[model samples]
Target: MTVKNGRRWSTANAYLRPAMKRPNLTVVTHALVHKVLLEGKTAAGIRYERKGNVQEVRAKREVILCAGSVGSPHLLQLSGIGSKAVLEEAGIDLQHELPGVGENLQDHLEFYFQFKCKQPITLNGKLNWFSKGLIGARWLLDRKGLGATNHFESCGFIRSKAGVEWPDLQYHFLPAAMRYDGRSAFDGHGFQVHIGHNKPKSRGWIRAKSASPSDNPEIQFNYLEHEADREGFRDCVRLTREIINQPAFDPFRGDEIQPGNGVVTDAEIDAFVRSAVESAYHPSCSCRMGSDDLAVVDPETRVRGIARLRVVDSSIFPTIPNGNLNSPTIMVAEKAADIIRGKGALSPSDAVVGMDENWLERQRSGSPERVAM
Candidate 1:
């Protein structure tokens, strides 16, 4: 429940900075988990590799796997707790059959809508060595500088269309035109929005290339495969155009750089999305949580058909939240920590935000009481 002004923080800047100083915690580095040591149907310990040699460590309680969406499932598969077909193909003996282990993989697809700016007030000016030195010097002198923030000055979440339950599309507005990876788009002044759908219906999977833990998994996101996903992206482009087209940007807005003026009509937009859309890189749910037949982990985060083994990461997210993975992932880890400690789940929060039924019509005007008096 930490809050600082209006900005959100990352693990390294928030949690781990103080955590690394704690005397009770032991940090292990460069160790690769070979497999979970299983005694019958129960997870007994861990077999890992370090310095080109295998090592074993017995777990006193349960073996928690927090290797994230891809790594978690890969470990489960290597330890013989995944789809029989995948495990068999990977040269591993099958011990459990969970067809959903590496399935239901989800990630947001994003593209920057770059618009040239008439004014020179953008990050492009700061790219030079002189400006970079000034920014660095300011930060060195005091903790305040341009480097303090990611520079995503503003953001928004909105529904793709009517009848959508909640906001599915997310927008991260950057004052400078650049890729999410920090790749420069132009030398002149410009701005962009890192916008995309959060709850994409498109699905894919992760498969271990072989039995070796070091090998990269075969990943196929199948992005924009479904009609809804494609349509959602189309809405993203249209809606963004509408936002930047507003009177406020008339002074700053210049030419459209991506999907340019020619990229109109459904077909052209579709093609542009296919060409320009990039992974928001929020991979999750390769080991989905549920009690159904395909569920890899149950609601309690325990791997089905295995005792003393649990996965506590984005891999077990029942549904990808309508946002980035950072906050939701941290919340997941916190709740999982409680569950691991055998504590009763905390009572649910009662706070709720009431949504307006006619929000689309009055979106610009925040008039009328949102909830009952």
Candidate 2:
């Protein structure tokens, strides 16, 4: 069988959409999984809610949590696999004291530097009514056009400086005029380079702010706390400036719009970055897997103190990957499906895994390599 998977869309669009027609798989969208029903420490089923009523559904073999980082941790906490104090207060029996269940949270912190292009090479200048109509026509006829732009058309993959060897920094070049603010402030003739950390040392956390599933979980991304992270961030900013000044982007050159051209000092950059940077929306590692006491799950993605429940999402990453996390998250799910089906999974990184520091050093030197994880 041949399957064509698009690059950027979520699994719901690619896999579940067509698979829903199959009788073996049932698609439940509106249902909210409230908790994992346990039978003698084994996850036998799930308690879910629909409309105003609650119900339970059994999993004959396993309950894989495909919930994203935040959702998965909340599910674990609700299922009594999180902090002991939090679980007890929520009236959940303490099944585990896995402090790491909602810890080790890492996210790509993004800083956008806006600029005005000299010419109209930026996407902002091209988004007129006619352009929109043409692009829409192309998309309707074939699944291609401006609609297919996932941004970051041109990217810079490098270390912060020449001495470093691993790729610790990444730059996403956007051809359009975008804003850190919402779509309203969008000017039609601007360009931006979104600078981000490949391996942010400043870790934060995910916590169930409220018991209600509708309520968003509190995400504390304590970014730029570590000295190394701050230094790395400064290097990333300098690198971004250097890349923008290169001949490849000369035609798109505009006045420095953010922190402006005058903000050159490291101290100024640090202050500006802290105030301006926001989430890359790549939250992960809240339910880290390891052999340590704090680890919420084991190497196999199974809950440390429970059985038959596996977290197959980004949460199980012991250490968050060094790039945009969606691809890595899908790989985790793929490997997990094998484990759940009694098929042996591949441990690609275990045989020749290097430490984070080595990778960071490599990034600092200029060659930001994609290491297997």
The local distance difference test score of each candidate is 0.85, 0.75
| Residue 322 displacement (Å), model 2 | 1.2
Which residue pairs clash in candidate 1? Answer: none
State how far residue 102 of model 1 sits from its true place (Å): 0.7
Q: What's the TM-score of each model vs. the native?
A: 0.92, 0.86
lDDT of 1: 0.85
lDDT of 1 at 104: 94
Q: Clashes in each model (backbone N, CA, C under 3 Å)? A: 0, 13
